[model samples]
Target: MMIYLTLFLEFFKIGLFAIGGGLAAIPFIQELSKNYGWITQEQILDMIAVSESTPGPIGVNAATFAGNTTAGIFGGIIATIGVIAPSIIIILIIAHYFAKFSETSIVKSAFSGIRPAVTGLIATVGFEVARTTLLNMEKYNKATNNLLSILDIKAIILFCAIIYLLNKYKKHPILYLVAAAFVGVIFKY
Candidate 1:
């Protein structure tokens, strides 16, 4: 009971402030792992992979995954609602008044400012994810001389292969996800 309420409130706060999109919510999710111990950094990485592969918004998927892991099925439901409620309410309000203020310079300026900030947030998330995925921090910290020992060679190779394939084929993203999952299972990365 108490857990459910906590999940709802925490996710609600995330949804309220995660301005850009699901990717924008990742820093908050990372903070949750650090602060609450509800999930681990590895689990957050898994959540991002699964969320990106599956349908639905990443933020909602993350909320569902976190809640389900923390509590149960009902917790996932509650958390999903909590994450989306703010967006729903805000959209409703904006829809009601946007037409009247659509031409206002203030509104335009606000959006112009928000765009760059959102880009920065997304870019930071991408860098963090890549760093976590490709580098072993434990190895880096422990290694006294060999700087290259920190690199996860197998993961880096796989990442490069995926990037090359993505550029070459330009097919639907799901194909790459499936291929990556297969490779991950086989390699145990």
Candidate 2:
């Protein structure tokens, strides 16, 4: 019961402030991993991968995954509701008033400002994720002085291959995800 309440409240706060979209919620999820013991950094990465690969919104999926991991099915339900509740309420309010304020400079300026901030947030999350996935910090810390030893060569190669394929093929994302999963399984990544 207490865990459910905590999950709801934490996810509610994330939903309220994660402005752009599911990707925007990632930093908040990362914070949860840091501040609470409910999830780990590795688990956050897994959550992101699974969330992206599965259906529905990534934020809701992450909340459900985290809550379910922490507690149970009921916890997942509560957390999902909590994460989406803010968006629902905000959308309702915006829908009611947006027409009246659509032409106002204040509203326009607010959105203009929000766009850059959201972009920055999303970019930061991307960098963090890349750093965690491509580089092995533990290896870096353990290494005597060899810089190349710190890099996860296999992961980097896989990442580059995926990026190249994405650019060259321009196929649906699911295809890439499936291919990556197959590669990971085959290579034991």
Candidate 3:
């Protein structure tokens, strides 16, 4: 179907550009979420969760998952392959040239320059994800109704506590995620 082809191509582009990791794919995925009604912002957050918990690279997992969600099992397969294809091909090309130019100063300098740019891109993606998840003005709209004020307070307190606890023990990411999920289920009325 045309839909599957589009999914594969878009996700392939996402995979190509997301140089850092799954988090780096957030900005692209958010754009995809907007471009296609195939998913939502909440689903993007959920995709991040699934990607982190999965066995392989988070980007690959996310591509396949989104593909499956959009089309079907074959969509998942195609998207995963499409996304990784460029990386595999590039690596092969690089590997072939690397041996010939492994000691070239210009290539080494180029890599050094690229490393920081990649890190910056990943950091920017993190900020966008955080803004999408937390720092939005619409959250304040919940204060308009007397019944909504309670929800607002709960959301703020739980968010603060989760952030504090996660920061205090940054080593245990899974624990923090579990705690956050518990807070969501218990506090979100």
Q: What are the RMSDs of all candidates, in order?
A: 6.2, 6.3, 7.5
Per-residue CA lDDT of model 3 for 6-91, tens digit only, reads 88788779778888666787788789888888878887788889988766888888888888887889988988988888788899
Give the winner by lDDT.
Answer: 2
lDDT (Cα) of model 1:
0.89
Each prediction's TM-score versus the true structure: 0.61, 0.60, 0.55
Q: Which stretches of candidate 3 lie over 4 Å from their true place?
A: 103-189
| Deviation in Å, model 1, residue 34 alpha carbon | 18
Sort all candidates by TM-score, best to worst: 1, 2, 3
Q: What would the per-residue lDDT of candidate 2 be over residues 1-189, giving only the tens digit for each residue?
A: 788888999999999999877989989988888888888888888989999989888888989998888788998899899999998999999888998897799999998999999999999999999999999877865447878877999999999998998899899998988888999999999
Least lDDT summed over 10 consecutive residues: which range in candidate 3? 145-154
Clashing pairs in 3: none
Residue pairs of candidate 1 with colliding backbone atoms: none
Task: Please list all clashing residue pairs in model 2, or write none if there are none.
Answer: none
Q: Which runs in model 2 stand beyond 4 Å of their true positions?
A: 1-83, 141-143
